[model samples]
Target: RLSNVLKRFARRHPDVALTLRTATSAEVSDLIRRGEATIGLRYDRDRSRDLDCEVLFAEPLGVVCAPDHPLAGRRVGKLADLRDERWIAFPEVPGRREITASHVFALFLTHGLGEVAWTPVDSLTAQKRLVEAGLGIALLSQSNAAEELGSSRIATIRVGDLAASHEVVAVTRHGGFLSAASRRLLDILRADFTKARGTNASRRNGVRRA
Candidate 1:
């Protein structure tokens, strides 16, 4: 999504010298805090006092499975319904370190779930591939996997009693000024996010009705 936003910005400001840096979420926050980067994008629900953040969008984050999984086409009534199921999880522990924090694990704890059975992987694509191979169910951002869900290669498992979700935030140093170029880029990003959010909401509603 950041790539999409940058493409538009580059087309309009062809002469602007733009540098793109990719890093772990912790590193991105640090870059903004130290004034190394004017803006950064991160996905998480946590708030930081050292930076100002504009929420791009927040949507239900849920489980997903391969099309052949027994629960693929089913809507679960509670988290406990799948407590014994295996998961594809991140290779980190929540609250141990900011860089290693796992929002998925935090969600599990929030639901009073005990230690879960999982296979850890650091790559999102790899995790999804594992799910496609029927290794285990994985946590997924509904909007991120729209294409797969639409094609029926993957199915979202919505828990009726769970309200877990995360937000994508545009962040910059607190009380800092954004250059005219950065401000223009942010405006474009916000507009694009609004359009995407509406589309995602419609898709979610349609799936529920089916």
Candidate 2:
């Protein structure tokens, strides 16, 4: 998605040229801080003292289970209700997983749910597959759940009153100057997400209406 945004920017501003490099959120932040990459797209909490950040969107998180799981048809309820389910989660070493696990743990702590049994997986796709196999439940961004939900391969249960979310943001070095190309790329990304956010909001609202 970030690369696509950059490509759109290059197309719009033909005179500008940028070398885009992709990395994990932490790697991107490190590259920007070390003056390697001019700008980065990462989660808001990953922002460091050496970087300045502009939040693009706040993405709601959801709990997913196999279609026939007991939680599938339940009304949105407390986060505690999820404590007993087997959980497929990302390994702790990845930057994204660190952020996600922290939030999940916070929810457990906040609700006095204690520790939950979770199995570490390599990627979101793997986690999804595990959930689809009825091996465990998993937490996912709504975007990642779209295809499965549409196919009835998985079902999502909202965590009532536990509205966990993550912010997507654009980051640059705190005092660094942006080249014309970098600035143009940032503009394109901001516009792309703004349009996407609106479209997604509309689609979700439409589904609710149905």
Candidate 3:
């Protein structure tokens, strides 16, 4: 979504030359720290001290599985219930892996379920394919799971007691100054996401429908 906003901004301001790089939140932060990129859009939790960040929006993460999976019809499940299930998880490179690992570890320590086994996959598309094949279950952002969940290609299982959320953020070097074009591009991105978030909030609150 942030990428799309940037694309539109570049089109609207053709005089601005934009170079964009998309990667995991961690990688984006690294690039900013190394001065490879002037500005970035990344998850708030993944931001580094090397950059200044502004919160854009918060999004929830949900559990996803094949339509025929045993947990498909379940409205919610406890984290411990997934102990024996085959899990499809993000690779080591993904920032979410660290967050997921911490959650898993905490759950295990509290419930004594021991360590759960999982397959590390790098791409969301591949992970979704694996879930649809009934090979395993996964954790995914609601935005990413929207199409599949709506089409019934996959089922969403809520984690009742778990608070899983991610925030999208805009970041730039702490003391670095942005060029006029870059600043204008940033303004466009902020406005675009602000509008999108308002729409999503309204829909979620039942004030409007998608």
Candidate 4:
């Protein structure tokens, strides 16, 4: 979504130089607080006084697996069938602030199937690659796996009782200077990010429904 916003932002201000930085959710906050980056986008909101957070959108996370995986195109209704599948995800610790790790298991624990087989991989790229290789399945947002999902290389595995999403928020240093370019980019984000993410979600859901 930010990429799309940047495309337009760039067109409007060709003189501006835009550099994007990537990091974990926790790292993003730290970067903003230390003035390493003028604008930061991260999952979930932070409560500290060093930054101001505004939610851009929620990216829905669901069961994603290889196209040929047994559960790829099925509507899963029970926890029993999912208990034994190999899960590739971030290790989840209850009551912790995690961007991508916790969504995969909360539903399992809620349904009384606390024991699950999972491998922890810190990188989202590695997790997706593992799932695509048929090594394991993962709980992931569509945006994170857009390329794979769009090309039919990966597919969504829907659980009847599952609902999980992480909010993508725009973060900036509190009482910090905002450049015209920065403010304009933020304006683009504020104006169009939801529609962009919403369209992506609809397209993915349509594919799943079909």
lDDT scores in order = 0.77, 0.77, 0.75, 0.81
Alpha-carbon deviation at 199 in model 3, angstroms:
4.2
Best by TM-score: 4
In model 4, where is the ten-residue run with the lowest total lDDT?
A: 93-102
User: What lDDT tens digits, residue by residue, belong to model 4 across residues 1-210?
Assistant: 667788999999999999998887788899999999999988889888889999998777778899999888788887557889988887654423453344556677777777677888878888888898999988887678888899988888888777677888899999999999999889889889777666768775884333
Ranking by TM-score: 4, 2, 1, 3
Error of 1 at 193 (Å): 2.6
Pairs of residues at least 3 apart in sequence or in different chains that clash in candidate 1: none
Compared with the true structure, what per-residue lDDT tens digits does model 2 show for residues 117-191? 888876778889999999998878777788899999999877776777778878889989987767767777788
Candidate 4 global lDDT: 0.81
**Which scores higher on lDDT, 2 or 4?**
4
Instruction: Rank the candidate models, highest lDDT first.
Output: 4, 2, 1, 3
Model 2 poorest 10 in a row by lDDT: 94-103
What are the per-residue Cα lDDT tens digits for candidate 1 across 1-210? 767888999999998889999765667788898899998877753367888888898756778999888888889898888778788866784422221225555666878977678887777677778888888888777765776788887887778877766777788888898889989999998999897788778876884323
Error at 102, model 3, angstroms: 2.7
Tell me the deviation in Å of residue 16 in model 1: 2.5
All candidates' TM-scores?
0.75, 0.76, 0.75, 0.86
Report clashes for each candidate as comma-separated counts.
0, 0, 0, 0
